[model samples]
Target: MPYLSPADIRSKTFRRKRQGYDPGQVNEFLLIIADALAGRLRLNPDHIRTVRFAAVPNGYDPLSVDGVLHLLEFQVRNGIVPPTGLNSGEDLRARKLPRSGTGYDRAEVDAFIARAAANLDGRGSMTSTEVRNTRFSTTSGLLGKGYQVQAVDTLLDDLEQELRFRGR
Candidate 1:
């Protein structure tokens, strides 16, 4: 496989989808990744592997984003660009999901994420089934804001997988 360079990352583009990864988030992340590839920023393979973007209407295709991310992760792991620092140790529970005009209730999703993170860390109990079945109330209108539905659902899918791996 050809090694991807900072220029390649910066120049890459994806197809827009009716519902897909948020373009703003993906573009921002791409800039960060490109900088890291150029040794202008410090980021580890784990950061590349675990990165998630919000999903939104008229956004970049998720499959395309995932493919690029997979390649980046593989390249980083293979020493194409040596990582200069350790994981940031940021708490997943503190990470905020992007809000949308019509989406899941932010508070509900936040609470669920906190609970799920605790369960994953062995501080609480939650089942894969629970994660699979979780749902949040939607919010809309001029003043109301909420977490992006597809983004939260994507996170729930990851959490469910982890829970299952842990035999929860």
Candidate 2:
């Protein structure tokens, strides 16, 4: 495999989609990763692994960004910075996402998390694709109750990885 340089990462671009990852967020994240790869920033593998971005209209394609992330993770884990690119829910029952005023509906997110935990423990069936496709109603207004969107999305990303690892 060809090695990826920090410059390559910095210059990478993704196709835009109607509904995808926020472009500014993705670009900022790429800069961070590039900096880390270039020894100008400090970021552990887990930090790269768990990073999340908001979804928005007219955003960068998610699959493209995710592919880059996977490569970056590989590079990070193998000490291949500038060369390569890249869960467990045990205690999922005890996991608590921070609440937000405008975010995913708490009830819906909790139920999904429960289901994900059960699936991880071999007590239920849930596919990575399902996790990837999962969506929840958004709570609106300052007083609205919900789970923090980033936290929930991050957890779901972990769960999806676990399921994929297990070939579920």
Candidate 3:
């Protein structure tokens, strides 16, 4: 069982989307996470799990952020972060994109995720700059169903942060 290092939690950035949790509140909570992970704070897993962030415009994406929080909660309670990368494609592959409207283009998101994972594994050639700056087109009328765009972008942004931190 591998614990999530403070550095790992500290370097993460939540993606902001409309009507998400307030960034300031989330940041403050993340500080607690770091301290707790570093043995400088005492907090129960429920403290992280049940935390409420005030709503504000362009705040942290709720679903994406919740996923991270769940993982953190698991780590704190169980003393082991799961054996998975933050942006692992396995979960993404099993995700069912909402069909009510077009989200991010499916193929593009999948391809980029694969490439990003490969890049981290030293099997792909995308530079950190390229991964940080890469953009994908959106789905259009009847083109295809898609995943949530903000979620995917946030994931990529976090991946970019990881790449840059490693490069340094």
Q: Which of the numbered candidates is closest to the native, going by highest TM-score? A: 2
Ranking by TM-score: 2, 1, 3
Q: Residue by residue across 15-75, what tens digits does model 2's lDDT show? A: 9999999989888988787656655457898887898999999899998888888888888
Candidate 1 differs from the real structure by a C-alpha RMSD in angstroms, to one decimal, of 12.3
Worst 10 residues of 2 by lDDT: 81-90
| TM-score per model over all chains | 0.46, 0.52, 0.46
lDDT values of the candidates? Answer: 0.70, 0.74, 0.67
Q: Which stretches of candidate 2 lie above 4 Å from their native place?
A: 1-90, 142-144
Clash number for each model: 0, 6, 0
Candidate 2 C-alpha error for residue 54, in Å? 23
Q: What is the C-alpha lDDT profile of model 1 across 25-124, one tens digit per residue?
A: 8988887886665544577889988998888999999988898899888876664742212112134565557778789987787777767666656678
lDDT preference between candidates 2 and 3, better one: 2
**lDDT score of model 3?**
0.67
lDDT score at residue 157, model 1, on the 0-100 scale = 49
List runs of model 1 lying over 4 Å from the truth: 1-91, 142-144
Q: What RMSD does model 2 have? A: 12.7
